[model samples]
Target: MEFREDILGAPYEAAELTLRPDDEGAVCATLVRRLVPGSERAVLYVHGYNDYFFQTNLADHYTALGFSFYALDLRKYGRSLRPHQSPNFVRHLAEYDEEIDEAVRIIRELDGHRQLLLNGHSTGGLIAALWAGRRAGRAVVDGLFLNSPFLSMPAGPAVRTVGGPAVTAIGRMAPTRVLPSSLNPHYTHSLHKDHQGEWDFDLTLKPAEGFPLYAGWLAAIHQGHRRLRSGLGIDVPVLLMASTRSISTTVWNEGLRRADAVLRADDIAAQGPRLGRHVTIVRIEDGIHDLVLSGEAARTRVFAELDHWLAAYLDVPAIEAPLIDAPLIDARPADARPAGESA
Candidate 1:
């Protein structure tokens, strides 16, 4: 493992974990850490599809609450992407277990953190939930937090029930085949400072058009969703959050600035309970798919709810400032939106 300054630069460190490859050549995973010296509690975050660990505001929020924060950019993603590997491609969702295992080992044994929290967004959320369930008796994680977890196909019931099997079959026959996707580029536009929002990140890693959705990858995701639907039985307290509403549109609209333009919020809320018995769900009004990256007002609410849940269920102490008020480490000019609107 080699530590280096992250893309956000200064104070933040990213550790590269090299892993053995399976027919795909060399691969690696990056552990982005905000080291709070002597901190016993830590949160290991996982990013969603076509995303990475550029959310320094999230790390600051956790650090302020006295917990060290670490985010894993899984193999073929962000800092881990290799020139020889397919970007964000995986034959099985379980393939990520190797990286997650190594990350948790480093955090628990190497770093000596006793209490570890697992936080995941979108596809990462599904991966984390499944891993926790698989490790149920091992007590690897103390709690789980999911932001807009992709529990089911956003296409609705027919796709999940019928089209799912067909996709899986195609995946087995030709795993590398690209699948048709209807992702709207406007959602990306709404999040970047260069476009319509406040955050600045590498468009190459998380492009506005997004990486191709391969048949194998889609099949793997549906399989994970099936496992989640059957119930995970994750033996830890779980906090699930999503936007109060979902707006699916191909064209840009003001609603894209507030509501989730990715996964269906209702789907997230409905399937959250299947993760465990101690699951609590919160719906943030006017929030985006990634709650932490939502507008200031929405993020404030998200942090408040998170703090309350952590205090009550995980026995985490309350911090004076539940949310970070300072500007993001990588400060960028805030793009003006309509009055009362926030991204």
Candidate 2:
């Protein structure tokens, strides 16, 4: 249900963040913003590939937490796309730093919120994590919330290891070359269009025929993945959420109802610690690829876990800083034990 209160009641205004052509003469990134009237905390959400900010409810969730939400539809994705540029194509993930930096500057100036949180989903999740790592000790972010982040190559090792290089090379050479993909009618059919699915985002804008996978995009992703796997010294606390099981992008099945079908849950569990300081990995039972967007029962379970984490982290009183400036750990640094213990 829509909150009865007037959202972003005052002074808050929606604005656009624009960048001009670099030496390449290609204008890039138009960051979008909708500031809260009088809210203090701000959240910047980055969406996954083939995704945009249609989940208005998620924005509401953050508003309820007293955070004004702003979502970025990256270059060549969603509202940021122009006629000339290709959709969802990039050679280096670092190239996105410009857009992200622009967004941050806008949020800080407009809302002036001390507590800034970064939330991302799927590929967006990876982007946010990498951004946070880059900003470590820079006093840029308060915490990070990654929901079912796509950290590793979703495709199996064989294709990903071999095909990835090929895709990157091809993308760089001829980014316009169309790749083959077949839609799974089952998954598409099940999504509630008006209510349950509750979205009619333009396929043209976010095409069912996803944009090409040029070498630039593939190479950038490989580079980003490598950085994530190497580990970042994120100074802030983090929460990583995922489904209890892995569901394939393969055709729909009753099993799809209960698993993350997109990302391997084990990957999330294994890499949770690699993210940063004091990380918590919560697995929601029966959750789908996007837990918050999951079907009925799983959705409830997903929110339940979210509540538990928030209560423990955000809701409770802040712990007083210890007299001595030191960190306590059950394990030593550079020491990664088995999954269960580390997580």
Question: RMSD of each candidate?
Answer: 7.1, 7.2
Distance from true position, residue 22, model 2, in Å? 5.5
Q: Scored by CA lDDT, what does every candidate get? A: 0.87, 0.68
Which 10 successive residues of model 1 have the least lDDT summed? 327-336
Residue ranges of candidate 2 with Cα displaced over 4 Å: 1-14, 20-25, 28-34, 163-178, 181-189, 192-198, 249-252, 314-343
- List model 2 lDDT by residue over 206-265, tens digit each: 554466655566667777887887897788778888876775655547776677666677
lDDT of 2 at 120: 86
Model 1: residues with Cα > 4 Å off, grouped in runs: 321-343
The TM-scores of all predictions, comma-separated, are 0.92, 0.80
- Indicate which candidate wins on lDDT: 1
For 1-343, candidate 1 gives per-residue lDDT tens digits of: 7778887787888888988876689888999888899899999999999898888888888998889899999999988998888789998888899999999999999999999999999999999999999999898999999988888788768767999999999988998898877778999999999999899889998999998888989889879988888899998999999887889888889898899899888777878779999998877877899899898898998998899888988788986665544332211112323565543
Instruction: Write down the lDDT that model 1 would get.
Output: 0.87
